[model samples]
Target: MELIRAIQLLKLNAVSTAWVDAVWDCEFTDAEPLDSTVEDEIKEDVKVFKKVYKQLLGFSKEDSTQSVWNVFGENCVSVKSLVAVLACFVLGAKAKSSSVEQRRHSLQAAAVYLLLLRIPGSVANKVFHQILFDSCLDIVLKCWPQSAGKKRKKETLKSSQGDGKSGKRPKPPKKVSEEMVIDEEDDEEEEEEVYFSAQDLLGMREDVCSLIQTLLKLLENFSLRDKPQSADSCVRLFTELTNLEPLVGELSFSEKRDVDKLQSLPELAYHGLWLLCSSSNHGEGNECRRRVFFTDCCTLFLMMRKERAKPCLLPPSQAVCNARDQAILFISQIVDEQTEATLPLLKILIQHICHQIVEKSEYRASGAQAVGRLVTKMPCQNYADFVKWLFNYSLNTRVAFRMFALDVAMVLLAQEEREADATLEPDLASYLSHRFLVRSVVYGRRSDVSPTVRAHAMHCLAQCLELPSHNATKWIHELFSSSSTAGSQTMMETGHSEQTLKRGETAQKTALTFRTIELTKHKSLAVTTRRSTDELPLAAA
Candidate 1:
């Protein structure tokens, strides 16, 4: 009766830590075994508790309405009460001698409770999240205790065996005096940590993963229907979790290679990617949030891709590539929506696109298209900043990456003289026509070691020369005169070299004439060609 009263008070938000602890103590410390009658009583209490929770939230067993969901953020339950309940649930889960089914029920109930409270989700919905997400993560942090306990027990047993082998037998001690000392030592040495098997860890992980996946799915469902504000809370929660430095370090464990042991880690990753994919499509108003999402997605994509390519282990089935594609698509969407990409974001996009271009990945074209579209639409200052950043970045990075950056620059430079409308700022035009840049690209074409890089640099230089601000005759002359610098031995024999220029010295002139005619023919048509967001292609199968 006392436990029931305490629980009722908790439902009314009468948060008292002492009362919560008392109730847990009384309920879990009952001396009698859980016979059918006691189990029936506990089940009835759960029913009553659930009913009271629903009632407090202005919901009913059969009632389902958005208005009812709105009550979640109304603070019907005080923060302290929510924390107390969740703490109690965590304690129950970790309780000594608790049945597996009981612990699972406790965790599941707590998860449902948290999910319900988050239904009125918003970016600022931290009241329930701090208690719930933090508490669940705390549970994960406690998982090592089981393994620790096993080690301690093994050590203690070994020590006892050593004592026995030494043949040291002491006189039996008096019951009241020496017995107390032994009892004290025994008590201290007893299992202070939770004792769980490998199966238990796997089960706990599955539960945690399922709870997170379900919560994200709920948010995704809300987002699909345009309820972004409701979904934003989940986004904020997940973003916070993912960005936590410790979480990744903990998940990337190499000690254990068992699939079941590490399966939950990948599952968490997949669901996180899914949430990112969904959020990217829905939230258009929050650029900062989207930027963070895409940035993390980029990092995750690289990690997942690298992990998948290792010959020893297969990546999570279908998920790595699917998530990667979704991330690329999201980048494309951001390019279409935002007026300009930040320098960091631009660099990441360039890096990712460059990899795709080099690998001939199906998504290569999509990434290239996104870069071109973003560059063309960016403000003149931003475009100039990006071009300068790319120039420096290419010089510092790998040769393959440098080629891609140059490809992006070439796409941006492939424009005719502005007629009446001036999108390119004056300083930017001057910067684009810098003599040093033109000469570096010319040098790259004539003498770069990698044929692919040279070919890309050649095309890039040609496009730069075609720009209205550039002196075409000077670049054309440089292109023709620099032919002798090309490696005759490497260029002549390699029939299928990705080299843009052929062996003959006359080929350079022909290439220049061909490029000039092509640029002139398409310059007018290219100016009017705008890529609509709807026409953005997906990753090719």
Candidate 2:
């Protein structure tokens, strides 16, 4: 009730919400475990402060935070309301108490946590994904309605063969075995009638979406802000973003990538890659700031440019063009306009955009014009490895679609690829293995492409199977095994994936070397004495 009342009070003071937020923040901070003498004394002081703040002066003092905190601090512990609420949720996450009261309080805390996430710029921004998901799982579990078994009707079967000498009826037909089947069906229907309260489930998905939007929005906000607001906040938000990579399905493309429609939404289309692309307080302790910003921007540009699941349903290439201009602008801002030198990561990320359009994007163009665009802007650095990976992943499979005609393949061939030799000194085979493995699983197997491409796809799947789980194979298996259509032209399905089964057999045998287990004959994991670990949590925000 205290939690509910405090939240309500803050919500009701609509006009002065910022001041309220600031005050609540202070109270939250002061509410931390303090001296016994100070704790009791603070309550009285808080009472006096609230009385003076409301009844007299009407908040004449510019410094309202001190008095406001003095009032709320008497009861609360953290200065940041959002963080204070999250701490409670962490309790809920760890505990297993069955008390109804605790359940209700935990649910309320979860609700409050969501509201703060929707209201952007809150300091609790980092854990938005974590809180949202944790709260969602809890809510869903509680929201499942209870049901009861139906009472069976008493029935007797008449004897068909009643020639008994004693005139006793023949044994009843096995307790109405045939008739009992009918009763079971009726029971199932009744059980399914149980329903969760709509008022409780209302806007659940919307609430979830709003939090995701805020997380995506922070990319832009942090990029534009004068400085990284708080290191703790930055760590939390981006860490949440990183953690969200696995829940990609829940955060998938809606197959609504219609160009005009996407153009209308603008920034909304570039939601995924936007965060990692931009920088905050560029000269901070983290040295990768400028490079990360550019690399992420480049990745975002390519993803947006690519086609989504449904045909003609993706953001306009013009949006990519706009972002490109923005990228150029950002580049000029971060690095001196005079410096033509580009980092290797940025160049790779940049060239991939063109790679996606010419070789990978589903949308069609009159010619392979996009290929020309990709190479024209290439830096002096060798990008042959990136080109080869793009060709193998995007062009070699039907899962990848070219935005332009294959007739222009000759021109693309003429364009320079980063040479596989002597560049960066990393094993090309290993990198190729990872790239192909992800491509195979992420896109699923395409039935429309040629056998050669399928063979190449199989090769990549084999590669993932070979690498350590710390490497490509584990992630590839997950991708190929996903039900998301954004991974390919359509949903790859949810149950056992044939792509995984067949390819996995091939991959496993080729890798591990001790045994030759075929990838196609895979089965459910064998149970062992050791408790099996559940799937790792993925970040998707």
Candidate 3:
């Protein structure tokens, strides 16, 4: 069937092979008239092609094409020979498609496997990953939801399409894109790095990290993106992971090759990784998340430089767009005012994006949004200045996702900075932001921050008062002095009481706690330095 379909497709342009050129000159002996078997073979080829091609690519059958179907049987040779020819033809289609569709017709892989008996379908679904087809396949692959393999309470999608027979009839999904060459003629060639720690040649962390890096770096590579093999990197990465003891032992193997591996790796592995990453597919029948999907994603970003792709990590083709945007925003957060070491990662990631996006005025704005998201997860209040820089950058550049950045920053602001003495966690920015909720002060007096963001900060801080007065006052002196500007100034005005404070309470209870900050008519400031019944006064209008 596969051969028949391929042959029919070949007949479309008829002057030669389905590809731009003619099939390699056949060495037929002085034409002892073509046998009738040749006609059957041709019909069979057309039938198979129409079946698998339509299903996998949403491609339509071209009419009146020749095939090589009927030429088979004991007369044609053993099933093994017939199968050999079928495999070769499909592989040819796969290779030709790399240049033609740019995707390996990955979606139709189920059909290829059936042809090879790797699966139970009526026809073979094998396809080589053409970068273009893989590109769109990556998008459709993302749609599978991590749960594709899960047994839902709802009726599960039957694995079998039944009878394994496809026809001239159209499949439900009929969308089509532009086309180009075919894979058969390319017969071609082309083609993961895994470092096993001495700790465990079989340990999954390193392998997992490498796989993640492959996906990330593929997205980061930016240069190979246009060609059909763009996803080749992802495929390669996933393939390497599959070979690792952890995945192979766990997933053991699949009837279908794991396509999520990384286009840069192997087609099937890329698909598996995608299954692992999504909520739906991750938890489906296969349950990729049972091992930890989110951890996989977060760890992918947290990888030590050595663990990631050589030079740097990148995301897969589909992830290229989203990952690039994310990496851009992530880098901007740690770049200037924070840790200078992060500059290297930022530079590398920047190299992987589209040149147009990299240099556009909008990138400045994107930087701001990215920084905002980063600062929320970072370790310092001073980073708000970074947020200011970002906001100003966004203001100047007019980038998209600004609101998202501001939202992330506001979430971070509500968090109190980590202890000055406690050694902080590594690398998510350098310090904790103050948990203050005074919007007017955070946004208005702090003027550098956005008003809406400050308002959110205020809302989060206000929640603290509800903790009960004893608790609220317990930390009053520290809350003011430790991380807040108001706290620091108040400490200076009144020497702290000699009383040794206890833990787990609000600062309001302190002997000389802040009652209210009243802005005097003059621009200079007036602060109330005692805990009292009144709310803090607003800054002078």
Task: Provide the clashing-pair count of each candidate structure.
Answer: 0, 33, 118
RMSD of each: 18.4, 19.0, 22.3
- Give the worst 10-residue stretch by lDDT in candidate 2: 523-532
Strongest candidate by TM-score: 1
lDDT by residue for model 1 over 417-495, one digit each (tens)? 2222276666566445544345443334444557766776676665665576555446555545656346433333332
**Candidate 2: TM-score?**
0.29
lDDT of 3: 0.30
* Residue pairs in collision within model 1: none
Question: TM-score for every candidate vs. truth?
Answer: 0.41, 0.29, 0.29
Candidate 3 error regions (>4 Å): 1-228, 232-406, 413-430, 433-457, 460-541
In candidate 3, what are the lDDT values of residues 303-372, reduced to their tens digit?
Answer: 1111122212222233333443333332343243334433322322221121112222234234334433
Across 1-541, the per-residue lDDT of candidate 2 in tens digits comes to 3342443333222223353355345543332332344324423332222222133222223343434334445655333543443333323422332233333333444444443443333344343444333433334234322233223223213235455886886765554323123212222232223333565334333333333343343343333233322322332233223222222122223223332222112233233233333343322322233323423332233322111111112233564444444434333333332134334333433333333343333333312343444434443333434444333333322222321213223233334333344435464444334343244332344332355334544554565465444445445555655563465433344312344334544334323321111112221111110111211111100
lDDT of each: 0.42, 0.34, 0.30
Model 2 spans with C-alpha error above 4 angstroms: 1-5, 8-71, 74-86, 90-202, 213-272, 281-343, 346-541
